[model samples]
Target: MSVSINKITVLGSGVMGHGIAQVSAMAGYNVTLRDIEQSFLDKAMEKIRWSLNKLVEKQKLSQQDADKIFARITPVVDLKTALKGADLLIEAVPEDMNLKKKVYAEVDSFAEDKTLYASNTSTLPITDMAALTSRPERFIGLHFFNPPQLMPLVEVIPGAKSNAGMVDMAMDYCKKVGKQPVLCKKDVPGFIVNRVFIPLVHEAVYCMERDNASMTQIDSAVKFRMSFPMGIFELADYTGLDVIHKATVEMHMRDAKVIFPHPKIKQLFDEKNLGQKTGKGFYEYKGDKYERVNLTEQEAATYNPIKLLAVAANNAAWLITNGVCDRAELEKALKLGMGLKKELFATMQEFGPQNVVKTLQELAAKYGQFYQPDPYLVSYRA
Candidate 1:
C-alpha cells in the first residue's frame, strides 16, 4: 500500500524540532509544532520567524511566501490537539527510551490509526523504539542533520519490522521537504553518517594525543588538503564536544570494537566545556558565537589528511559489505551530510585502495584493532 503524508505533527519544540517543522511548512505541509509548555512553543515560533525573515532578507524567499509558510505552521501545547488529523508524527523529543515510550503511548491513544510514526533520534536504534508501538510497521527513523532548515541530508532508516511502503514514503517525505535522503537499510547504531563520521573524528583526537600533532595543523590539513568544510577538531567544537562525547560513548557501547571513547573527549564532556556553546572545547569562542578557526596553508603541510579519510573509507567499506548502504549512497551521505568538497570514494580512489588498506593496517598496528582494515576494503579494486 502507498502511504501519503500531508499533515505533520512534530513533538518537541527544541532546535531540531522547530527546524524540522519550519522546513516541512516551507515544503507546503501543514505542520503542528508542539511542546509541553506554551513558552517552549512560543520560543520555537520566534526562531522560525527569525529564520524565515533571514531567508527573506537574503532573497531566498519572498516576504509573501514566508508569511504563508509561517501561517501554515500552527504552534500548539496540547498533545491531542497537535496529533489531531496528523498524517505523520515526528518525535523530536529528548533521546530517552523511557520518555519516548511515554510519548508513543500518548500518541497511540490519540493519533489516528493510519498515522505513521517517525523518530528523529540520532543515536537510538529504530527497531527498539518501533517495538514500543502497536504499529511497528509504521515506525521509521528520519535522522535529520542539525539545523534541518538548511541541511539537505536526511537518513531514512527502517526498523526490522518497518513496512517497505512506509520506508519509501519516508524517503519521499524527505525529498518533499527539500532533503537528499539516504536509506540506511539496517537500523545500525549511528546509521550511515555517524557510523563513518565518529571514527574519523576519533582519528583526529588520536593524532593529537599519539602523534603530538597540533590541532590547528591537523584541521588545516583537512580543510586545505582534503577540501573538507571544517577541520575535524574544529567540527567537534562547532558540533559541541559534549555532543560528540555522548555520541561516541553511545556508538561505542553498541559496537565497542569499532568505536573508541577517547579519554580527552570524555574529560572535556565531563568538565562541561562543551564547545562553542560553552565558549570552549577544541578551540575557544567568545560570547557563545562561532568564529572560524584560523588555519594557514603552511600548517596543512604537517599532516597527511589521508590518515583521517582512510578511517572513513574503511568504515564506508564495512557499511557496504555489511549491507547497511551501497557505495553510491555512502558517497552521497558523506558529501551532503558532511559537506565534503569531493566524494569520499573518489578520494579513496586517488589514494589507491591498496595504499588506503596499507595505511589502515599501519594505523591498526599503532593503535588498536579498531583500525584494522575490513576485508572489503582490503579486497577493494578501486
Candidate 2:
C-alpha cells in the first residue's frame, strides 16, 4: 500500500525536534510541533523564527516564502491535537528505551493506525521500541543528525517486524522532506551510522587513553594526513563529549565484547565539561577562540590512522555479516553523511577482511588490548 504523508507530527520541541518541524513545514507539510509545556513550544518557535530570518537575510529563502513556511507549523501542548490526522509522526525525544516505549504507547492511542511512526534515536534499536506499538509494521528508525534542518542524511532503519511497504514509504517521505535516506537493513543498536562510524571516534580516544599516542599527534595526523577536515577528538569537543560518552555506553551495552573509550569520556562528562557547550572538552574554548596543536607533516603522516580504521572496518564487517547493513550502503552513508573520502571503507574491502583481523591482532599484541574478533570474520579466510 502507498502512503501519502501530508501531515507531520513532530514530538519534542528541543533543538532537533524544532529543526525537524521547521523543515517539514518549509517542505509544504502541515507540521504540528508538540511538547509537554508551552514554554518549550515558545522557545522552539523562537529558534525557528531566528533560523528563518537568517535564511531570508542570506537570500536562501525569501521573506514571503519564510512567512508561509513559518505559518504552516502549529505549536501545540496537547498530544491529541498533534497526532490528529498526522500521516507521519516523528519522535525526537530524549534517548531512553523505556521512556520512548511509553511515549509510543501514548502516540499509538492517539495516532491513526495508518500513521507511520519513526524515532530519531541514535543509539537504541528500532526493534526495541517497535514491539511496544500494536502496529509494529509501522515502526521504523529515522535517525536524523543534529540540527535536522541543515543535515540532509537520515538513516531509515526498519525493525524485524516492519514491512517493505513501510520502508519504501519512509524513504519516499524522507526525500519529500529534503533528506537523503540510507537503509539500515536490520534493527541493531546504534543502527548503521553509529555502529560503523562512531567506533573510529572511540578508537581515537582509546589510543589517547591507552598511551598509544597523544591528542596533539592524533589531531594533527587526522587533520593533515588522513584527509579529514577535523580530528575526531576535536570534533567530539565541537559536537559534544557528553553525547559521545552516552552513545559509547549504549553501543558498548549491545556489544559487550568490544572495548570503548568510556573512562576518559565519562570523566569529562561528569566534570561538566561537555565539549563546546560548556566551553571545554578535549580543549578549552574561550569566547569563540581555542588554542591549536601543531605536528610536522612527516610526523603527522607517520601517525597511523589504520589503528582506528581497523576497528571500524572489522566492526563494519560484523554489521554486514549480521545483516545490519552491507558494504555498499555503509560506504554511501559514510561518504554522504560524514563527508569522508571514499577510500576508508573501500580500503577496508580492498585490504581483505582478514587483514582487518591481522591489524587487530597486531594492535592487541603491541598494546595489550583488542576486541574479540567477530565470529563472521573468524571463519572466513578471505
Candidate 3:
C-alpha cells in the first residue's frame, strides 16, 4: 500500500522545516510551509533561495529548474489553508514535546484522514507524539538531520502503532527526496543517532572535565585513531554545545541513569558560548581548519578510542535487548548518521564485544553506573 504524498504540509518555518520544505519542493511535490507569522516564512524563503542559488552556481541544477522548485513552495501563515489538501503532514516544530503535540493536534483536526503524519523529532519518541493524532497508524517518524538539503540520511522510524505500509511509504518518500533512509526498527528516546551519539559526546565532555584527557588529546585520538571526520569536541563545537547539552538534558530526563555532561558543559551553555555559532567551543572556531592525519599501525593499535565507543555500544546493546533494533540496523544508523566511515559492528567485533564490556566495566567501577555495561551486554560477553 502506498500513500500519495504529492502535496506536503510542513509545520514550522524554522531551519529544519524550511530545509524539509525545500527538499520536498525540489522533489517535485507541492509544498505548503506554514508558520505562525508571515515574517518567519519570508526569512525562511530567503534562506531557501540562497540555498537553491548555491546549487545553481555549482551547476548541480539549471537556473530554470531552481526557479521551478522555488515556485512550487507556497508559504502560508494560516494553518487551515496550509493543511488543506496536504497528503502528508510533517511536524517540524521545536524539540519540546508539548509544542509538537499541540501542532499535531491542530494539524490532525485540519488534515484529511488519508494524510499521513510524520514528526521530524530527533529524540522524542514517535509513539508519544502519535498518540495526539487521530491516525496513529498513519503517524511515523521521519527524522532529518540539520541542513536537510546537504545531509543524505533520514531515519525512518515506526511508532508502536504505526502502520507497516506507512513506514515503507516514508522510506520511499525519503528516497524520492534524494535522501538515504535507514529504518529505526522501533521508536525510543534519541532513536538511534542520539541514543548513541549523545552519550558518546557526553563522555567526551566528562573525560575532559574529570581531567581524564585534554580536549586536544581527545580530538586527536578520535580523528587519528577512529577515522572520524570530526573529533567529539570539534563536532560538539560545530553542532553547538548548547544543542548537545539540550539533547543530553532531555535524554537524562528520560533516563536518569544516563551520565550527563560535566558542570563545565552546563557553564558553557549558560554563558551562550555555544561552539561554532558563537565563535567558541572546546576549540575556538576562529577561521582555523583541522588537519587530520592517520596514525601508524602501532600508534593506531595503542590509540584507544574505547571510552566513547563503549558508551555508544552499551546504548546499542540496550536498544537491541529491548528489541528496538537489531545489530545490523543500529550499526547502519551509527555509521551513516554519525559518519564513522568504518562499519560500526565490524569495528565492535574487531574490538571484541567482550572487551567493550570489560572497558565499560572498568569505567563503571572507577566512576559510576553510567559506564557500567548494559545488562544484556554483560551477559552476551559471558
Candidate 4:
C-alpha cells in the first residue's frame, strides 16, 4: 500500500508536539495540533506564535511566512476531529508507557488505515507500544529531539512487527519535513544517543562524587579542552540532572549489563538537587544567571575527562560496528541529538581505532570499567 502524507496530526500539545506541528506546517502540510483540553491547545498555539515571531525577528523567516505557517496549524481538543483526514499521526506525549498506550488506543480508533502512526518517544520501545494499536505494522518510533523544528535528526525505529514498507514511508515523510532519518534495527533502551551518553554523564558525576574533580573545572575542561559546547556537569544542569538520572535508571532496568547505575545521582535527587530546573544541581542558579561554586582547578586538570569521553565515543562506534545502526547515522545522531561537534568524529578517525583502544585501555586501568574500550575497537585496528 502506498501512503501519500499530505496532512499530519500531532498528538499532545506540549513542547515537542508544538514544535513538530510548526515544522509540519512550515513544510506546507496541513497540521492539527491536538491536546486533551482546550486550554492546553490554546497555550500550545500561543507558544507556536511566539516561536514563529522569534524566527521572523532572527531573519530566518518572514512575517508573511510565519502567518502562513500559523494558518496551516489547526488546534483541536477532540482526537477524532484532529485525526479525521491525517495521513500521518505523530504522538509526542509524556514518557509514561500507560499514558502512551492509552493515547495509541484512542488514535487507533480514529486514525485512518493508511495513516502512519509514529511515536516521538525518546527511549520507549515502539514494539511495546504498537501492541496497543490495531495497526502495529504502521506504528514506528519517530524520536525527535527537543525543540523539534530546529533539530534535523529523527530516529526512524520500526517495530519488530512493523511492515517493511512503513520504514520507507516514514523515511520519506522525515525527508519531506526536512529531517535526517536513521534506522534502528531493533528497539534498545535509550535508542542510540541516550544509551551511551547517559552512562558517560553519570560516570562524570561519579567522578565528582569521588572528589576527583569539581563541576566548574570538569565543564570548563570539556568545553575548552575537548571543544564540546558544555561540560558534562554543565550539560546535566542544563538538561536537568533528574531527567538524566531518571533516564539512566530506566535504561539500566531495561538492560542491566550495559548501564551502570549511579548511587550518587539518587543521593543528589534525594537531597532535592535536581539541577538548573530547581536552581541547584552541581552549581547554583539565580534567575537567569548561573554561578559556578562546585568546580575546582585541581579536579579539572588532574583528572583525564577527555579519556572518559573517548570511552563514550567508542561505545557509540561499537553500536555502529555491531550493526545496531550505521556509522554515518551514529555520527549524525551525536551531532544533532547530543549537540556533539562534528569534528569529534574527525578527531577519532585521525587518532585511528587501534590508538584509541590503547588510550582507552590505559584509562580503564586507571579509571575502572567505564573507561574500558569495547572489543570492536580492539579488533578494528585502523
Candidate 5:
C-alpha cells in the first residue's frame, strides 16, 4: 500500500517551507511551493538559489544539476493550481491551529483525494488535524527541524487514525529527501525532542535563577560535562529566547506538570533581546550570526551537569515506558535532533540510576512535582 509521491505541494514559503521544497526538488520530486503572495514565493526562490549555489560551490552538486533542481520547483500563489496534481501536500504554514485548519479545509477542496497530507508541525497533535481533513488515514506529521536543508533529523509521526502503511511510506519519503527519520509512535505535545528538551531548558534556567548559577557556569557544565555540542543557554539564544518561551507555554498547556514557561526567558523576550537575532539573550552577542561563548574548563566544575541530565532522564523514562518510542528511537532522536555525542540512557546508567533518582527527588522537593522521578527510572535505582 505505497502512495506514490512524485509531485509534492508545499503550502508556505517561510524558512521551513522553502527548505522542504529545496530538499524535495533535490530528491528529484517535482515541487510546487505556494504562498499567499508572489513576493513570498520570490523570496523563497532566492533563498533556494543561494542554498543551491552553496552546494555547487562545495562540489556537492554540479552547477547543471543545481540548475535543474532549481528548475524543478514551481512557485505559485493559486490554491487550486498549487494543489492540482500534487501527490503529497506538506503543510509548512504557521504554527497556529486555526490557520492550519483553514489551510487544511482549502486543501481538502482543492487537492486530489489520493494525495497524502503531512504537517510540518513540531508540537501540535497530528491526530487533531487529520480528523478535520477528508482523509484522516492519509494525514501524518513530518516534523523538520529549523533550517531543514542542513538538519538531518525529521520526526515521522502517525496520528492515532493514520494508516499504518502510510506511516511506513512517510518514513520512506523522509529518506528519499536525504533525512534520517525517527518514528514518534505517540503524538504527544512536543513529540519526543521538545517533550524532553523543553524541560531541560527550563531546568537550566531554574538552576540559574533559583540556584544562583551563572549562565557561563551552567553552559560550561552542559558543554564540557554533558558533551552536548551546544550549551543549554547557547542553544536557547541561537533558537531565540522568545521561541523557547512560546514552545514552553505551548507544551505546558498540554501538560502542566512537566513543562512551564520560564520567567527568565519571558523577561528576555519582553526586552526585545531575542538572542543571536537581536544580539542579546542569556549572554550577549556581537552580530546577527552565531558566535560561541568562551568558557574555561574550570568553570565546568562549578555546576553539576547531572542536575540538567536528571530532568532529561525522568522525561526519557516516561517517553520510553509510555511507548512513545523505544530506547533506540529516543536515543537516536536526542542524538540526531539535539546533536548529543553521548547516548542519554547509557549516560544515565553510567551516572547510576539511583543518583539520577536522588537528583530528581531533590529537584522535585525544590521545584515542585515536575521533577518527581518516574517509576521507570526508580525501578533501575534498585
Candidate 6:
C-alpha cells in the first residue's frame, strides 16, 4: 500500500512538538498537536502564535501566511481524537525509553493502520522503540533538530525491522516538510550527529577540567579559528551542562565502547551549575548579563582546535571509506545537519588521506585511544 502524509498527528506539545507542527502545517499538511491537558495545549498554541508572529516581523513570512499555517494546526487534549485521520504520527515526547514505548503502544492502537510512526528521539535506539508497535515495519526515526520549523536537517533512521518502503515514505515526508533528509542504515546510539558531537563536547569539558584551557579561551579558539557557531563551552552553557551530562551517561550505558564521561560535566551537575536554565555553568548568566570564566594564554593554545577538528574529519572519512555513507551524503549531513563547513573535508582530501592518517596516529600516540586511526584509515595507508 502506498503511503501519503497529508495529515500529520504530532504527540506532545513542547518546544519540538509545536515546532514540528508548525513546519508540517506550513508545508500544507493538516497538523493535530496532541497533549495530555488543556493547559499544556493552550501553552503550545500560544507559543505557536508567538513564533508565527515573530516570523512575520522578521519578514520571513506574511501575516496572512502565518495565519493559514496556524489555522492548519489544531490542538487537542485527547490522543485518539487528535490522531483520528492522521496519515502519519510523529512523537516528540521526552527521551525516556519507557515513556516513548508507552506512547508508541498507545499510538499503535489509535492511529490508522497505514500511518507511518516516527520518533524525534536524538539518542535512543530506533529498533527498541519499533518493538513497541505491532507493525514494526512502519516504525522509523525522524530526528528533527531543535526549533524544527527552522532547522533544515532531518535524519531518517530505519530500525532493523522497518520496511524499505517505510523508509522511502519517511524521506519523502521530510522533503515535503521542507527538510533535507539523511538516512541512517542502522539504529546506532545517538544516531549520527550526537554520536560524534557528544564526544567532542565532552573532550572540551575535559580540556577545562585539566586546566588545559579556560572556558572563554577554549570557546573563543573554536569560534574564531574553526568558525564553529560557538565555542563548545559556550554551547554547553547555552544547552545546559546537566542536559549534556544526562545524555552522555545514557549513551555511555548503551555503548560502553566510547568513554565520554568527563569530570567537568559530573561536577557541574553535582554543583547544580545547569547553565542559563540554572543561572550558571561554564559561564555565569545573570538575567540579561553574561560573564565568561577566565583562562591563561598557554591553556588556550594547548586545546588545539585545528587538531581536534582534524580528528573529527578523519573519523568522518573513515565512516565514508567503510561504506557507512557516501562522501557526498556524509558531507551534506555534517554541513546541513551540524552547520559545519564542507571545506574542512575538501581541504583534508587535498592534503591526501595518507597524510591525514599519519597526523591522526601521532595524535593518538599522544592524546589517548580516542584519536586512534580507524581500520579504514590504516587500510588507506596500506
RMSD of each: 1.4, 2.8, 2.9, 3.0, 1.4, 3.2
What's the TM-score of every candidate structure?
0.96, 0.90, 0.91, 0.89, 0.97, 0.89
- For residue 5, what is the lDDT in candidate 5? 82
How far in Å is the alpha carbon of 126 misplaced in model 1?
Answer: 0.3
lDDT-wise, the better of 2 and 6 is 2
| Candidate 5 stretches greater than 4 Å from native | none
lDDT of 5 by residue, 1-382 (tens): 7668899999999999999999999999999999999999999999999999999999999999999999999999999999999999999998888898899888899888778999998888799999989999888999999899999999999999998888888999999999999999998888999888887887888878777989899998888877788789899888877767777777888778767556777788789988888888888888666588987679998887787888888898889888999888999999999998898877787778888899889878876888888888988642
**Please, what are the lDDT tens digits per residue for candidate 6 over residues 12-71?**
999899999989998999999999899998999999999999999999999999999999
Whole-model lDDT values for every prediction:
0.88, 0.80, 0.82, 0.79, 0.88, 0.77
lDDT of 4 by residue, 65-120 (tens): 99999999999988889989888899998888889878887788788777888899
Predicted candidate 3 versus true structure: per-residue lDDT over 118-145, tens digit per residue: 8998878788888988888888999999
What clash pairs does model 2 have? none
lDDT per residue for candidate 2 within 227-343, as digits (tens), equals: 555777777787787777778888888876544555777889899898878988887777766544444566676576666667876677678788876667877777666666654
- Clash counts for all predictions: 0, 0, 0, 1, 0, 0
In order of TM-score, best first, we have: 5, 1, 3, 2, 4, 6
Q: Can you tell me which runs of candidate 6 are displaced by over 4 Å?
A: 209-211, 288-303, 347-368, 379-382
Better of 3 and 6 by lDDT: 3
Per-residue error for 99 in candidate 3, Å, reads 1.7
In model 6, the clashing pairs are none
